[model samples]
Target: MPLPTADTPWPPVDTRVLTSLADWDAWYSAEPERLEQRYEGRGSLEQANRPAQYAGGLRGRLARWFWGQPTPAGEKSSKLHIPLAGDIARTSSGLLFSEPPALISEHQGTQDRLDAMAKSLHPTLLEAGEVCAALGGAYFRVVWDDEVSDRPWIDTVAADRAVPEFRYGRLTAVTFWTVLDSGDTNDRRLFRHLERHEKGRIFHGLYEGSLTALGAARPLADHPDTAPLAAMVDAEGGLDTGAPAHLTASYMPNVRPARAWRHIPSAAYWGQSDFQGIEGLMDALDEAWTSWMRDLQDGRSRIIVGDHLLQSLGPGKGVRWEDRRVYTGLNMLPRAGDPDPITSVQFAIRVKEHADTCAALTEQAARQAGYSASTFGEHGDGQAVTATEIKARERRSLATRARKALYADPALSDILAAQLAVEAGFRFGVTGLDLSVPPKVEFQDSVTEGLGELATTAELLRRAEAASTETLVRMQHPDWDDQQVTAEVAAILGESGRAVSDPTMTGAEGPGTHGSGPVE
Candidate 1:
């Protein structure tokens, strides 16, 4: 059935909804802030004497070089410790891939078709979605035959572009909006709204632009294929239709029509940034390094040019002695007065201590992000060497990964399902197989813990008869389903030339008995 028109009144959004979305906007801004600190060394040094260091000339260059201050305000630097934390999280999270799960019958064929379609599209969906998840939450929209492109396309809208309408803690509708340049003689507003129907799984688009140089507001015409949208516009060029045409054009056989869209929230239950936890630590590390650099440059050296001695050199008292032997070498010159002529004394700052402290803070930051010292190539002091064992898994990194998977897995599945629906509707056949059965998508996780910890557990299970072979195999390969496990067991027995025996045989222990040997 067709969905309602865009002109129908939407449930009024609560004031808190706007506030919540604003928070997500702030969260998204953090990525650029982090990038600035990482590559540009922004806020690296805000010392009391920063203005002096920024004043151009030989003095500014000397202070910047010797004091470890950032480059002039507009330029960027190569300082990178802050970016390293973000890199660690991304690299350690592992590679996530999509495939058909056990839920779908003949899922392999469905998955292969989805894979081929993904390759044909630009800015592969995987890369786009990952970037959005890292920043906060993103809206994945599957648009077909947009004015900009003829091919079916997947576009990721940032959180700010997607306004999610909620009812009783569930998302009922999502309105994806954007701005366009209408190229009128006068600078006028041009807004576009593409809303998705949650119940009917359809898309409704409306464009409002200044139709003339006078800057008068009017509803723009619909695309040639979407003529039904014209009904929504009233005589005054306002929205009038209460329903929009089903926008997706499907060409595949056996594919049901559905919306191929997904909303991936980086953190569960709300939009949370991946870098929120470690941002403070990164700032602290930068501050510590900045302070150390400032003190090392300004506090550790002194020049003793006396007030009485200044008159001898006149205006040249600010000596150009940098290259002369008199700068570092001791020169005993005759003094006219008996009073001490030494004008100043400067003590060296504790450079080594500050460096060690910063290192410790950096390590703590890594730990908070679920990384160890070894992750950044740093060795812990007096660390113990113990046998490899499966340690407890409760780090922020792991938790974040799990939470993202919780959202991404289902979202990806829905995207592929929608694609299948479109293909089936259009009867656009696959290469070799019949895509009659809708395929369920599953994401394959190739990321593991830092120490290859799973290997030790697998070895222990193989060496000792801790449980039934099936149970052991399941533990080792958690992603494997029951059928795969059974097939593996049968293959093993066949290779060993052993016959299977029933556990409930005569004179044998019945079910529910403990301390039993391997099932074979």
Candidate 2:
């Protein structure tokens, strides 16, 4: 499809898409004000006026608690936000990338290139993974600049910033856009730079538009950011990528089906956000934390004194509590057997109650988000369990990580293949390298077995004569390649004097005889 032209609708996205993205972004940001604004914009006027009526379902109750019960004017309560949403996103990324995945290619040169790329792109991939988890998906675009780097580099675009075209649930093309300049609110002059990526070419266009409409298509040189790209544009207004069979961009969804927008066909291709389905639980968790803090604040002890006890500072000045040990001729007695004026008051803090509430909400949210409560450090009893017991506790989380890895592997393979294709087609770096095959993406295990446990298992296998030396070595160091394993096995045999020498054949003796003796 062609790029959006003049008078085209801005964003070209459904309202539901916008709303979902906005809510996910707000929660991922973990800003209390942002969340409050989102909740305020939802529901009806009656619901807004009577928050008690809003407490109907789980979400409504959470919203009521998070926004607080209706308070008198100028008596608004403080709300605190726990960054559990952000933590979930970060944990998702860490689970997948704490140990970088290996992009292995059969060809030696291609493997070398992949290794070099992985070294530089590991951190970028982690950041992209986090954003992907938070926003439901991310886009990987391959671009090159000889001035910046010799080879094509990868860039990540957040899901909200791009309009993707998919064929049969596969991404065919994507247009990434950014607002270069936004004029005054009244003027409504917006300069948008759009880069559309397709199989063999990238189209760049600048648009002078309003927030709701693309007013007109401007020349590339009209904007400072797009000016340099003017020199690269061909007669067709796109830079020929030279590789026509493959796309220069790929979409990596966080997870499949995008349950939140499954009803909306246009947005269904997007991935599901980590914060989806459990937003209310997270909000309630935040509310619990906020209420706990409020308890601390309101629990401070304060002395209640009569007007006679406080000394006047000066004219037009407020009275002050004199730091005196004793006062003479002061009215110490209460009127008509009333309570003492000098009584102290302090409210009790519901620590255990709030702690339990917060813990329960956090566990529910984590579980609802496809992770175990223990994944977020909510292990019951806080006991030190064996690795087997720990794995049992985090079975849900491990399964989740495996699912995410499955989704990521293909997208990563495609993008890395595109990168290699770009380099080989342009002859930019490492010429004559094979780019016909895409590399395989192998993610390291999220949970590694203890060395001692692995050694014991290997010993048992060896005792049963089931595992070979090479197999034992591989089990001990799963990260090692075949060559490393072979070398280690050979060294072990040689060091143990168990290396078998070829039997010598003597004419006098029978063939296949060992040493100088014949077969007995």
**Which residue runs does candidate 2 get wrong by more than 4 Å?**
41-77, 182-188, 314-318, 323-339, 380-386, 427-430, 481-483, 504-520
Badly placed stretches (over 4 Å) of model 1 are 1-108, 115-135, 145-153, 181-269, 275-286, 299-302, 307-322, 325-396, 427-520
Worst 10 residues of 2 by lDDT: 511-520
Clashes of each: 16, 0
Model 2 sits at a Cα RMSD from the real structure of 4.7
Global lDDT scores for all candidate models: 0.47, 0.82
- Write one digit per residue (lDDT tens) for candidate 2, span 302-399: 88877777889889998977767876765555587556767789999999999999989998899888899888888578775667777888999889
Q: Compose the digit string of candidate 1's lDDT tens values, residues 1-520.
A: 1222333322223334333443333333444343343323322423323554566888566445321354556665533233544454344434232322233436566656655665553244444444444444555655554456533555566554555654543344566555555455475554454554443255455555332111222333533423455564344333411112222211110011111111333212334444445555665676677677767667856667654444344475653323245544446676577346655678778788888987788778767644555545565355644322112222444444455556655554554555555444433332443445445545444343333455566667767866556675676677787889988877666676663445555344654254432346
- How far does residue 55 in candidate 1 sit from its true spot (Å)? 30
TM-score of each: 0.53, 0.88
